[model samples]
Target chain A: MQRIRLLKDRIARKLMLSLTIFSGLIVFIMAFGLYQRSRPILAIKPLNELLFSTSWQPSSGKFGFFPFIMGTLWVTGVAIFIAVPLCLFTTIYLSEYSGARLCKWTNPLIDLLAGIPSVVYGMCGVLVIVPLIKDHIAPFFGTFSSGYSVLAGGVILAVMIFPIIIHVSSEVFRSVPAELREASLALGATKWQTVKHVVIRKAMPGVIAAIVLGLSRAFGETMAVLMVAGNVAKVPSSVLDPAYPLPALIANNYGEMLSVPLYDSALLLASLVLLMVVLSFNIISRIILIRVERNIR
Target chain B: MDRRYAEEKIFRSLTFASTVVIFLTLAFILATVIAKGISYMNLAMITQTPKGGYYLGKEGGVLNAILGSLYLAGGATFLAILVSLPVVLYINIYSKKESKIAAFTRFSFDVLWGVPSIVYGAFGFTIMLFFGLRTSLLGGIITVSLLILPIMSRAIDEVVRMVPTELLDASYALGATKLETALKIVTRQALPGIMTAVLVAFGRGIGDAASVIFTAGFTDSIPYSLFRPAATLPLAIFFQLGTPLPEVQGRAYASALILTSIILIISVVSRALTGRFTRHVVK
Candidate 1:
């Protein structure tokens, strides 16, 4: 019986170790699989023409990714531009100004925001933000829009990512040692000065990591952006103009992808682009986060 | 001196305003979903599947989607736990704390956790094509399990890592093997956290639509087999809203309300169960 127990223990350890190894290799497998699926498009169209040309007539075998890529950049850029300051301000207040009771009360709310489905956000955008923008904001700016524009997508996405940015940067701010704050106060620095100079400075790298994580999330958000961005298939000249992002392209055109020659491969290539960009951003943020954790230790 | 004080006041108010703005955004989303959803919600919407011409504004329910979401998320969560528990256990129990392989494994999970659901959907489609498998419930479960495994494992690993080394040493001195100690002591100590992680992953899997859109082809009827197409709530909302009819769009809001209510219930249940399970934990 003892020998049997020993054998069981050995078997369990080996099983778990192999599982761990498999988990580590799964990321690479996903990337390679996506690449293989996208190989047909790469074979037919040169990389530069596929990436740089603006025409997207799939029925005629013309698949240019430039407009979609531009749409992604514009929307993500606008989202980050709007979200960063709001997230920074929220993080500073929650970490430094709020009482523990207040912070405790807020934590669940942030998690709730994070847990809400993307489709619901999209619905809310359709009901509220879209009409507001089309009726009020665009008119105020002396522009015409259908309310389904890059600005609308960016606004909704900015809100969606607020929880991610706040949750992370607030944790980063919390880990800034209390002694550092106290020491700054003892030297006659104001609370604001201490926050501006000491706490923010100390948490800078982690804050960047948090923002990068949010950026990656915004880059690949499909449902919410797809709902409000109008899926226009054109590069927007302004925020009010309708634009179709890469993820939106994949989601919108995927149903009939098999009917058109090379269409499926093109959509698969879009996902590959999304995967590569998101994975790279994740890696960058992970490196910064690991370094920050090491320093905290 | 006056200028410094003025600057402090300005910055403080700005930060306070921003914090309020975020809270207000959450309130706005909740209120909008509830208000719009309530007007269209009905008993039949939860009890029966879509009838013919349902998309054309006929009467029917999202029972097909409701049941499908439950089964897909449930199966995915179970599969994820089966895989995640072992991977985390290996790192925390079978390997050294600072082992290079363990660190690398954690890093890979973190990266995988950030991969987009849409990409997962596409990759799942790729795998399906290779196996000559059409879109079905099994594809959704496999894809969603892959999507949530990193989330579940990382969460459980964090909790298990907090189990004291002294507890393990005591078990070892009592002639308990590492396997026995892990199953009996460490798992018990981390039960509450593990439960929370499981629920969190389940909520994510259920709420996710992009990863399942192609993998789980929508059906008006409930899924009865793993190989059959399954409809999910998020996709139901998406398709319903895509219609031109106001009534159909109203149903979309109703479905959103249902999804939101489910997540709220999950959050509450996770907290309640955590309290109940913590009775046996040492700390």
Candidate 2:
């Protein structure tokens, strides 16, 4: 008791401690609720069946998760594919060639684009982007009559995530201590050579991290993807196919499911996937942060 | 020299051309939305709930939707602050040795921030259905709170750690009570920073469509009961756009513009608040 008094007050510490537990109680409770719901409700009997089964029929009490999971991965994967390369090239060009005056105007425009709400993107897609794709790009595929294809959704998601990847990678590139650029330039290297050889390599990990973060955001994105992706719960053969990702399925189905166990389980199962992805994203970004900070003088 | 200049000219043009293509599309989108939506931004729109087939010309205004946005976002933001601020306070004050549980709490918070809003919506809807509050404002509020809790707590946690240890020691040496010290001294200093988190949470709450999708399903009429389904601007847009009707379609664009403008306003305010607070804190 004397030692406690000699130290700072421990009694008050106990109250704050309770506060900490209460804050985390919901995440704990929700996670527990999800696990409890996972077994019987989802009918996820064998790991292979859960992973491989194609049909997801709630009417017949057959709940196979393969298609929806594949859809999410495919859409997000396509988004990343379209986004990462363009943003990388854009970042490199901006870092190496663009003037400060131009960058001053350019960078914040991207931020504004980034912060524009997702629903607006969905609306724009609904009105403008979808039609443009339908009229122009989807004809290239020549398979779909109307263009609510995975390709169109991925294209929009790519545009949506572009700012994130560009912003993060450009920040990383800008941090590479201009001395490196100057040194490469001094060695008679062209500006393009200096950037490609020096800046891109140095910032690669951060760029990867940024792309992964963008991937995570795209994976969990609901409103924009839901509005545009032509929510047919099927597997996509190409980027030009219509589909439903896991988030869309949950949003579309939760209302009409008359207390069905499969309904609850499918939603929970989707959430578990979302949870794994977002956690992986944070950890990857943190690793990049660790490495970036470690390398800094 | 002439060849190099020509090459550089081509590179610069390409760079400018690509940048313009991307940003010009964005500008065109914003301009169209604003120009189309501004006509509907009447006082009635700010205050009243219209019945079926609401038109700016006919049904008076979007008063109910605006107010519902405020009510839902305001309640959710308040609830999140209530849970988050105290937890961050505990994290700030707990002596390193005594705070293993606090450490664990923070570990979960990191995970929570990344969880998709739809998942929260799903989890929340599950519970609300169990409790007989399906598709209600209460459900919406709880879901948004859960969504923002981790984000605000993390922001608040970082801000609290900036309060100097010297201040803490001095307050303790003077025999100020722990509550007094944390509340009066540390929190007062951290107020601007904490307010940034609150503002951020509010902006996030307003912007979210995902968290409230299942929890706050759309209704044509304004909800008189917390348990009744309510329409927000985002949900309204989703419904209007999703419908097969053309009239509902035009309204979706106008409504989407309205919804997006609200989120933009919120984002600008939060960013400005954080900037102002950062300046204040640095002083």
Instruction: Judging by DockQ against the true structure, name the best candidate.
Output: 1
CA deviation > 4 Å runs, candidate 2: A1-12, A21-28, A42-44, A93-111, A140-144, A259-261, B1-22, B39-47, B52-61, B93-108, B129-132, B161-181, B274-282
What digit string (tens of lDDT, one per residue) describes model 1 on residues A1-297? 888878889999999999999999998888899899889999989989999999999999999999999999999999999999999999999889878888989999999999999999998999998999999999999989999999999999999899999998998998889999999999988889999999999999999999999999999999999999989888899999998999988988768999999999999999998999999999999999899888988
- Candidate 2, A58-118: lDDT as tens digits: 7777677788778888889988987776677677677777767878877767867876767
Model 1 CA deviation exceeding 4 Å by range:
none
Model 2 CAPRI rating? acceptable
lDDT tens digits, residues B96-199, model 1? Answer: 98999899999999999899899999999999999998989999999999999999999899899999999989989998888998899999999999999999
Candidate 2: the clashing residue pairs are A151-A239, B45-B62, B47-B63, B48-B63, B48-B64
DockQ computed for model 1 against the true two-chain complex using alpha carbons: 0.87
* Chain B TM-score against the true chain B, candidate 1: 0.98
The fraction of reference interface contacts (C-alpha pairs within 8 A across chains A and B) present in each candidate is 0.81, 0.45
